[model samples]
Target: MKTVIRYPILFRAHPGRTEKPKDVLVPYLHEHDVPEISEAETHIAFRSQKYALVEYDGRLFSKVGKPGSNSAEACFGHAFEKEELRRRPWWIPTIEGDKVYIRYAGQPLDNLAYYRLYLDGGDKARETMIWPALTPDYQRHLGGPRSRNEFTFQGLVDKIRDINGVQFDAGREEHRAEAERLIVIDGSYWIETTPPAICVAHEGRMIVELSHLPNWLDHDLGRQYFPLTAKDEAIEYARRAQAITQRSEEPVRNFADWTDFRFDDNPLFAFDYEGYSLKRTTFLLGGDIARAMTGNGEIEGKIGSARARAVLSAKEGARSCGADYRTWPDASDLVHDVTDAWKMTGRKPGWTEIPPKRHEFGTMICERAAQMADSMPISVSARSTWTTSP
Candidate 1:
């Protein structure tokens, strides 16, 4: 809900004034210059001591006092020409045509103050007098005969009432709501669930439902995906894979050997001594080895010798797979072949169609894990499976 208040004031060329009036610029009044309004039962008790009017260039100009003073120096002629006035510190003097008719137009309630002063005890007729004080000049600037109702005290009162009514109606319309929903959770920012949900806070109150949240949050949260393993664990696997690959044996000796290796019925894939199979061992031991190597920025102890050799063999196998895929015309067929290779080992397919780059492959695995995590139970045992070390 929003609310706006408007204060509209129209200054008519006083009464018999001539040329088109210029805009009035009111300078800011100092604290001491303003008089305090006392609360009254029927009407507010405001006085006119804070204001003063002086004649300047055949026109009347009004000024408000500076904080502590009840009277302010006149803002025209030789006094206005002074260095202090040139600074134009607080208030902007009002000018209408060549005549300076009013000052303090920028101040809040300046016009109202004058109205109240006139009603109380000030000379209403004298205050109403206009500049260029002639009927002929008034006709030239005003364009037509002036109506009795125009620029009258009653007119100002009516304008105030009209503005107040408009603001009140606007405020009411803004707050009118179609439906209401109360939040059950106080501080929860997000919720874990299928088609996951999030909470929004407005004015210290949480909104749980999707429709009630802000537009930006709604759009971003909709596209968000959580991975199974934590991001750090995925990154660790990539680093280990990279390190192992760097130290592995080079590719086959020549094209004939590579072709013979590819077409042979009894494919002789490289295997380390333990015979657990390099790819299987790499998939299983990569996480644990990485953890031990980088645990506290140093290698804690000897990595299991057998596991290290198997990791090296896995890197060799990955290099072989990459070479084989490059010779194949169809990429999809390569993916199928890799899947078959894993199946032959009685394990899940861990490598992609193209040889997986360590970092990208690790990220893919983590994202897959996160998606899977969304459906599993919240129990600790179930959660541990996502990043369980071999």
Candidate 2:
């Protein structure tokens, strides 16, 4: 679904005024050929970088650039460094492949150069970072020094309120007003510019917010409401109803600690490099049991499949899969046969013990069962000294 969002262009200065420096179009406004798009929610802290935020599917994206046609690399390079892009984690999905461009409109070389860049719709997956020109009004409100000579932060806050029709509450501090204005204002602006023809709620209900709004690109409002992001200023509205719906449904589950595990602690590493399995670590042995067993000597292969099954079936079940055992046949041949049987049964022989087959209960089964029955719980001390012996 394509959702366009628009904001009023606040010129840094009223165009045609002689006193101020000529409206200097910054790199964000000038360098891009295509209208760069941003997701607003992901871009909540955008002022840190001179960019506008757009929200797509509850996630935020930012679009930064100047006016009138240039390679995306040059525009992005001027504002951000290569290292910075590399360092940005989920906040900024890395920009990969090709320089995309879009032609800009509302070009008046003279006094009217003070507009915010307009974001045009483009394929997001291919072009992760973008630069788009804005209307002069948006430029005025963002509050940065205009022209290289005298760039002071002014007019940004007022412009935001004015552009979005947000009423300032006298009860709050000015900074609070500023923040609310920016968030709500940008959200409202985006909704107006990209007025969605159809909005699907989180519960799967589809809503048509506008029957039709004037489309600035083709100048047609006959089909549905003008998307909030169109270049048109007259038809902008914030559609935060969808956002509300999304938050309301899910009971906030905070598994943040485990979900946000870092590179060094990725449990997958414990499984692939070492022999620890997730079932054995997270739930079975409390937490991070693999790390607990870091330096023990050849403890892994010493326990045979039957011993493993017996240990797992204990009251503690598979939680004790890493336990120590006494009296095991040389696992060289046994391990292979057990592993083969495991594949056929699609079960980890170390974790489950099935009844012996007819004629199979002779010596092998008895010995295996005896060893497993004798296995002991892996001690915390043993785990701390765990190791792999060649």
Provide the lowest-lDDT 10-residue window in model 2.
Answer: 107-116
Off by over 4 Å in 2: 1-96, 100-150, 153-390
Worst 10 residues of 1 by lDDT: 177-186
lDDT measured at residue 246 in model 1 versus the true structure, 0 to 100: 30
What TM-score do all the candidates reach, one by one? Answer: 0.13, 0.15
lDDT of 2: 0.23
Query: Model 1 over residues 1-390: C-alpha lDDT tens digits?
Result: 111112222232213233443221111111111122211211211112232222222222223333222222221101111222221212111222222222221121222222222222222232243322212336646574242112222333332222234433432232121001001111211110111111111111111111111101011111112121122432343333333333223321111111111111111211111111112223222322322233322222233344344333433333222111112121211222222232333332221211233344334333333333333345434664487569
* Model 2 lDDT per residue over 257-365, tens place: 1121112221211111001111211122111111122232232245444533332232132222211111111222222233333233323222122222312311232
* Local accuracy by lDDT, each model: 0.23, 0.23
TM-score of 2: 0.15
lDDT (C-alpha) at residue 328 in model 1: 15
TM-score: model 1 vs. ground truth: 0.13
